[model samples]
Target: MTQPPPPPNQPPGPPPGGFGAPQDPPPGGFGAPTPPPQQPPAQPPYGYPQQPQQPQYGYPQQEQPQQYGGYPAQPQQEQPPQYGYPNQPQQPVQPPYGYPTQPQYPQVPHQPVPGAPGGGRKLSAQLQIVIAAVVAVALLIGGGLWYANSGGGDEEPNAKGSSGAATGGGEDGGAGGLGGGGKEKVPADTKAKLAFQLPVPTVPDVTDVSGSWITDKAYVKTGVNSVVGYDLDKGSALWTLPLTGQVCGASRHMTADFKVPILFEATKRVAPRYFQPCTEVGLLDLTTGKLVWQTSITGGTAGDKKVSFSEVTLHGQTVAAGGLDGGAAFDLANGNPRWKPQANAGDCEDLGYGGGEGGLVAVRKCGSYDDPTVTVQNLDPLTGRPVSQYKMPPGVDFAAVVSTKPLVVAADVNDAADDGSGVSDFFSIDEKTGKLKAKITADSKRYAPRCRSTRVEGCTQVLVGNGRLYLPTEEHDGSTGEYGDETNEIVAFDLANGRMVPEKTDAGDRYTLIPLRMDGGNLIAYKWPPYDKGGQVVSIDGGTMKSTLLMENPSDKTTRTAETSFSSIGAEFRYGGGRLFIADTLISKTKASTSLYDKKYLAVAFSTAG
Candidate 1:
């Protein structure tokens, strides 16, 4: 797991400038701000050999210019103009897959100091102007560089779960199932039309509004302090279940009957106690838009203190939650305590759990806080007892359960993976024997799966099914000759031996593909839109790895902008019954400078039936 870097030391006082107010400049003269220290060159992803630099396709190469002082200053010949912005320099450099290219520095002529051996000579006026212009260009390019932050479980008697499925209209209650079971409805026409959009609710500050689900009649989502079920086609409120406090966490898995688990505060936020602990757990019935039951437990050191949870998940009849304080479980149908926090001999506590139709798995931590030993266990859903346990390799302080049925775990062993994706290698274990089967090394530079370091079931864009693991390759240069046009593909690895599968699915030119979930034996995926196009949803045959488009959204400016606003990396996506839904997990207060006529949405839906 990657830990945030420690904060830089600060003077013992308020900021040099009071909050939101300007302050005096430093004592030293100020011209251009000091250049940041040069960072060490990035290394190749862990366990992979570094390849020699080579000229990449789609980019033109130019002769290298000699340094100023090393060779006598000679007349420079004019070079052919490069592509892209006017006067932009083009160097033939290849960035690591999925990573932004390092900024190229322009060589400048060295100036002689006043008392130096070369003696001082004033630069020509034209030369000074040229230098200033070069500096300005560099500054502009540096300022434009921005970075993106990229940030699941089991099982039981094979609970008939659906993968990315939602109920369609009609008396049969629509097709497709939720989480892992059932067949997805295939529409006659693949082209999709706009159905409706739900506007974002106004909030006083940045608020966590995570969690969403799709039912036979409604698209359910969490709001500021309530859960609202919206008409699937009309986008109007079907029903709203108000809560006393904000939702803190929700289970990704929905039961066969459409019930899900969630965590929330006991009371609404107010005054100095503006933030409340996420101590209450509840079961929500999406079909009825009601809280089936709500309850909390007393744990921690004193035994009679409320336990706060960071996440909750459901499996079979049990709904389990875990946090720093420990873990607790309850009957999913009714709010009855199944088990509470209990530390083992080594003071190990259940950090969290990953639950789905595949089964229930837990991540346990033991030993001293500074030197923790993490273990992954397959547990009996009803008994809260380990069926089989796999102790993580030494030096692995954290682990995430990606799948429980086949038993796959991901961890950044020895913290060698520098990327914040929280994974370096995957361990395939024998669920019955708790023995290691294969350790698959996923090079962070080449693979695109992301998992939150702190959340035991937070892995995304990665899937396990049919005895294989599917992952997206890091984005790379596309076939098109146009610069900045990138694409990626999905590849599979055999879970038995950890060998790469020959068959793969490509995302086509300018589009990046990511695995959404498994629909029976098929893999559902989303194709991220290019700048001028709308997004797409496709189903890849599990055996052939061939994709069939299910829905392609509108490419008009208005629709394209709205569709692209929800990033493929950060937003939640669901597609089934010829419909696709995209939603946000967080919403922030509108800025004062924003126009009133501009629209913001919590979710947008599209369908082929429209």
Candidate 2:
């Protein structure tokens, strides 16, 4: 089918004010992402790789541009991949097939953070300006597109329901999925450029993102109605489908070996009855923005309902969905049910299913303080048959699933008494046989996800904006079966065991550690604390754990009584223009005094940056 050529004007043509080309690709080379359908860890879905910015390791250190001084200082001269040279992502390994799909980050209760009793020295005026510059540029550039996409012109979104294109979200829903949601509908004709709008009506949270930077294509999830994908270079909607809800997207994309889009969606719905629907998967064709398929399991929002989750691949296919018994799998091409393991009902827990030269691996768990059943089963992605299953020690239960190199890990969770004291355990199980490969746990207090020892449930699966697998853990307590407190620490571990980087944060209730790409290899971490307190977005120094604060609360320096919670961020390509889309947390309705957190109601495009 010959498609309509893009309009006369398009992006990748010239920069605003015809500035120099986005120079500073990383030192080695551009993180070249191959064409179509690949693996996990979706990353910067567009542009050339910027210069490399090494993150500091253990202690707090200052970030020096000299460390990434390899690339030429010029921003122009960036080009596409060469045919003969094999361009692999300079980051994490390839993701699985049949990727996850969603719009906004799901609303899960995060860890509680206490306001730090102490205060650090206020930053100097010079430091504040530098930090403000990045954000200001981001806001200024992104805001323009956000306005144009936000239906400044009447758009018939619900009418041409399947077709999509919006202004990138502004401070409202500043990212991709943020602009598209269950809110008021927009007209179909209100087409804005890449920085214009996100595909989803709300912003999907940003999780585990990693990939080579290239302007080939990117993916986005709008409201429950559909998921839209686009070509990164041109910034246009490839396809759109009516799947509905705020969806969450993965950071790392599958490698080019597989002929599929690296992006997908997963949505969670909050009903009036306090019935939070289970999570369901959504897949989109990156170029066409078409809804290729959705999960078809019973009880799941889109058939697969799950709280904790994991996904694995086998024989070029991907499986790892939640079910009444456990997570299920489907063929990537046609959403075919590949396998269905017996239903146990603990919590369908997290999943890790992958098939490679070694063998197929699948892990599933079900249990908690109330749902009692701790079974970790390893199976074949192609056969859906279990080769082994491990019983979580009686003291602990499995929280969410995490992906490790040679194994699939579950941040072991300890059952808690009514008093709220929990235990912790960490184990890296063989992805092939489901056997316990390695287990780490602290003998003292429970291992908390926020601690340096306890592994954050899905940390391994998290892809820093750069292409790498960053697993964050605290400590694991397998004995007493309780999780630790936030006082421990947060660290980004190199899955390959090359180096363990412990990143620090000022936020007390730090939960997840988010990584974003700014320029070349330069990466920044967005630490979202659990409570109403604002978090920090830090620039890391590869050699030291030292961080440079890029942004902080401008007005609300001290934690205010207002319950402000940040939501997830989504990564999507901005079509027909020079922009990347994202879903961000503008403001939430939570009240701090109540000790309550509100689920994300909407996501907006906060700003735009290269």
* Candidate 1 RMSD to the real structure: 20.9
Task: Report the number of the highest-lDDT candidate.
Answer: 1
- Per residue, candidate 2 scores C-alpha lDDT tens digits across 293-403 of 666444222235333332323334553444233445667677776544333222343233434333444433344546544444444455454444444443344443443
C-alpha lDDT of candidate 1 relative to the true structure: 0.66
Q: What C-alpha lDDT do the candidate models reach, one value each?
A: 0.66, 0.32
The 10-residue segment of model 1 with minimum total lDDT is 144-153
Q: Write candidate 1's Cα lDDT for 512-574 as tens digits.
A: 998998998689999998878889998887655778888889988889877877767778888
TM-score of 1: 0.70
Candidate 1 lDDT for residue 110:
48
